[model samples]
Target chain A: MVAIADSVPKPVARFRFILDRRNVLGSIMIAPAILYVLLLVGVPFLMAVYYSLSAYTIYDPSWSFVGLANFEDVVQDPVFQQTLYNTFIFTFGSQMLGLILGKFGALVLLRPFPGRKFVRALVILPWAVPIALATVAWQWMFDSLYSVINWTLIALGVVTRSQAPNWLGTPHLAMLSVIVVNAWRFFPFAIVIFLAGITAVPQDVLDAATVDGAGFWRRNYQIIMPMILPIVAIGLVFGIVFTFTDLSIVFLMTMGGPVGATSVLGFAGFQTGIVSGDVSHGAAISLFMLPVLFIVVVAMLRFIRRREV
Target chain B: MGSGGNKNNRSVTRRSFLKASGAIGGAAGLAPVLSAPFVSRAVADNKSLSIVQWSHFVPAYDTWFDKFAKDWGDKNKIAVTVDHVPVQDVPARAAAEVSAQSGHDLFGFNGSGGAHLYRKFFINLADLVKETEKKFGQVTTIGKQLGYNADDGSWSAFPDFYINFPGMYQKSLWDGIGMKPDTWDNLRIGGAKLKAKGKPVGISLGHSNDPSTTWRGLLWSYGGAIQDAAGKKVVLDSKEAIEAAKFVAALYKEAMTPEVLSWNDSSNNQYLASGVASYIVNPISAYRTIQQSNKKLADDIFVIEPPKGPAKQIMGAASEFYGIWKFAKNKEAALEFLKYYRDHWPEAFKASEGYNNPCFANLVPKPMPILANDPTSTPPTKMAILQDSDKWSAIPGYPGPATPATDEIYYAFILNDMMTKTATGQSSAEDSVKMATQRCEAIFRKWARRT
Candidate 1:
């Protein structure tokens, strides 16, 4: 018996034959993704670069080519320097705190216990809920006049009403507050990464380590950590990238204040580009993040590729 | 062979029928898409207007304004749409609209109008201004400066209303302290006493409009400004500016809490309504809010002129204006709508509960009936102080037009940060002034080249 497809039209058969080609099929499959990235990411990125090299502003969309003048100007700015410094501190502080919390959280969840699934679901809430809503809720908690933290502290006689700490007001405290909120938002993601890496370690390997007289600490730090380093490193790359470029928490919580204590490159870019309407300088400020993030991604990806098991 | 032939014929018929149906269905599906441009053009060419503005702090104002817009649309046989965004999001929203080069026909500037900043995207409103002036007389000084370009002699926006920033104080708190905040000295002294008693004055020191306006008032009151009257130079590093910074630092240290450093535009309003605040610099919306939420506190709240400083007693006013975008599709309708809206200024003011002060001198004349005898107010005349507020009011970049330079500085919160730095002991008054001056010089120089 002949195949039913044999009766198909010559054009349809020819088109199916072309679709069946491996390279063509592969290309067609990824066409949407490539188009998505090109349109959304590539176009905007190129536009930003173009804007950075020009004297474009919302008031005057002249697009006059200025040739690095904006970068030179922002580089010389004392505030921009402060912003750069704050960005590093914010990113490092949040990433470190997140990874540490995530490691411990994963270890806790790893042990079999009652209501483990429920507890795991709760851990995912911070990462799952909408960030804007969460940030607004945090804003109220850190409010100057009605901070719940201050209320509790005062109630506990830890501090008087007059002396209660202003979390989002004082420069140091504001920085610390933003870092804490960012870490809280990012830790759940880290926890999942850690859980995956830990579970991927074979039981036989653990059993062999145990037989070799390796203790919990020894296995965790010396054996398991090195084994999981590649995955954790990948997670760290994402965490750093997200935390470093974050604008929402800072914007909604402190607005880069009390005197730009919590100002980061992303927030500064938005303030300059959007609020101040200096598009060229804003583009420059935002583009400054690229090199740092690029380096991180390259290093982690290289490490991941080398450690692929 | 005959049966096989019949099966093949039936199969071909079904396929042909499917192709015919698909062609018909495809046309049906694409009909709306293909005709959309013509439909939109027909609507856009006539009888349509759209507006975007900050959602008023007073809820009743938005309700009344939307209804007013719909009524006007109905009367004119036009389709009108209104969009409201949070006050804090207005600048970003405007920036987005300008970037896209397409948005509502008329855009409302709620605070210090950005007519000068985004002037290129806005239509020249000089003719509208002249027409309004012919009927209602000259616009108020601050109103004109807020939306007019001195160089081109063009009005970039039509001045609508100004919100008077008064000294909203807790009557009982001041009475208990045996003082009133009539002057800067008295404000500091009384505020300190109140602070010692656990009731501190609340004014924003953060990057929001409240701080932007309030700090400018303080700066001007000390004989300092961001620019000279020519609006050509940065004059923020003056001795008087240093003094203003020093005075504010002292005030912050002695009279206010550190929390004020994180306050937004609405924070002070919330602070005043909380009953723990002795004083706050805000519009009548604060009092209006408490009237609905806390009547007892509302009764204790009263408005007064902003504290008189050593040099002058000008108050920083938050003005509202409307600009027609250059890319607007319904220019004629928008202009007509604005004229109609202007004719109903008194009604708009009433809808705002007297919060909206007319920019036209004759639009809502002196001793405004609603303000002088507000039935909703506790004493029925408590809001009378705002009747003559325009006399003491100054827009952003006072002593000069609101130029691109001042727009940059105001939105950047440069002055607010300078004050905050000194007040928080992060920088000395001189250093803060110097730093802020550097920032302002950069901005002024940039705008100088462009303008």
Candidate 2:
């Protein structure tokens, strides 16, 4: 009787009796989520693949199959090449900086302090503020002529008005400025995650390290880090994906300028596809993200699973 | 008997309303494809028009336009709605409307770029333009260059107004240096001296509309043309074009601040209004803004025609276009409204505080008291030099028409990229011009085939 009930279709089988099989109940519970993913991620991703194989314009309805040509055009263009280089640099630079800074902030906040709650909120403010508004403010702060940073530097005699650096004008500096903004925005979330991971370490484990005379760095790198390797991996995965695909900072601040030195994959795709109206080429540029991000996610997941094992 | 209450009456009223709506929808669906706007309005029984326009930089202009539109609607018994969005987001919103096949009957673009790109989606206004032109004196030649499409012999959009892209300078700054900001060379040289004093020129080199307008003036003045007069060939690789690039590189290094590489449409205005910039290439709006905040600076500031390059006295202008969408729901009303607006534009010009320069000959150099002496300027002759800008200025595609090809160049900001590349020394002037020529040719070829 039970076997017969299990073999029945889910909707029909559900009312016949209370679901006994864990697998069946779980599948039924997750069906809506599976459908959501299929409709949202799977559909758009498939559409992107199709678009990358065609020549499409945003203003026109007609398109033709020119298989792999869009990909070739994207890969061969010098500006696009620079954008690819910039994407990796930005993602890696921001991720490493964010991780280090976040870890430091979390450790400090973990200790007892005055107004810790308010301090925690302050640490999270960069992440909490709307990115568009934040980036616009940053754009002004980095302005070549009116930058407060330049004013401060001038006051300190570190730089003169004529010698002041144009934060978003020089190519390398523009890339660095974008990465700095991205890192600052991203580190708050990292801080929260690290805080949770640090708190999760068993009292005994920390005590063991303490009794063993481990320094703060030693404890963080050796005992605490190993114990929270899985959590760190998760944080890194989210940070990498967010940093890799970030468009707002570069778009609002530099607009991928200084000869596209600050152009990341996301901004380049937007400029080429949306602004320029070459939708297919933009899809191709966007699709490059898939393979790179997929590998990152998979590798991090695998590393976490290995740690668990 | 008493239970026969208001519920039944409400239900009956709703049924009647739905039936009327259904009939209207049915008729509208079957109307001539080109007359979608008219058919929809006809079945609705009430004359209502909707419009979308930029939240104008000069906020007072919005105040005037909205009040005037509402008053007109009241007199004509037509309900009118005007929606405003930030200027930069206009194209996306318009594109969304086109995709949805439903939106305001009329939309405005500050430049002809988006209008030309979405040519297939705009109503042909040739008849309307001709009538308006006949009534008002003919639109300035720049207006014809922007709105008239030779491909279909139709006005893809109606030209309404133009803004002169001239140099606005601080008189005291120039005086202190024993010079005047008259020519491009003078600007570069005098500007360098001022930069040493911590005030630099603020012409944009970013991917924004200003650079497209400002640099074209520079490019044209240097005998450089992005394309030949035919609009069919790429002519951006000439020595003239390279000279333009080389000159800009020197200016970028010596006179202009590097912050211009990241400027948005509003940045230069801020730079100038804050007293950090000695001169900028902009319309009179910036000076007007400064006047309200800093009458002292406003008194010190003066306007001049765009400095001459090596070639001639060709200034750049951004011609605003009024495009009624083909899918608009109130086409007849919208067109009528445009005719009224065009004939009544002098009033708008006054309301814009002399910022709205009319596209017709007679409408301009108007005896409007505001022009003779704007309350916003110290000298009162603040607008005098700008009166005859039509005599010297050209739109984006000067040598050529402002075709979809040129529109692409403007929208993608290929000219800005070329300038940025040359200015930043990422590529030599010759290499940058070559690159720009190649890119421009690709765009022109793509659109040419379609046309």
lDDT of each: 0.88, 0.82
How would you encode candidate 2's per-residue C-alpha lDDT over A1-309 as one tens digit per residue?
A: 534544546665566455677787889999999999999989988877887887666556456787897788667666678789899999999898998899899989999989999999898899999999999888878886678988999999998877988888777888888888989998999998899899999989888888989888898899898999899899899999888887888878877776677888998777666665667777899989989999999999999999999
Model 1 regions lying over 4 Å from their true place: A1-6, A9-12, B1-46, B111-113
Candidate 1: tens digits of C-alpha lDDT, residues B262-305: 88888999988889899999988888889999989999999999
Q: What is the TM-score of chain A in candidate 1?
A: 0.93
What local lDDT does model 1 show for residue A150?
92
Candidate 1, residues A159-237, lDDT tens digits: the string is: 9987998888888889999999999999999999999999999999999999999999999998888899998998999
How high is each candidate's interface RMSD, in Å? 4.5, 11.2
- Worst 10-residue lDDT window for candidate 2 chain A reads A1-10
TM-score of 2: 0.88
For every prediction, compared with the true complex, DockQ reads 0.53, 0.25
Full-model lDDT, candidate 2? 0.82
Candidate 2 residues B227-338, lDDT tens each? 7886778788899989999999999999986778877677888898989899998877888788889988888888888887767987788777889988888899899899
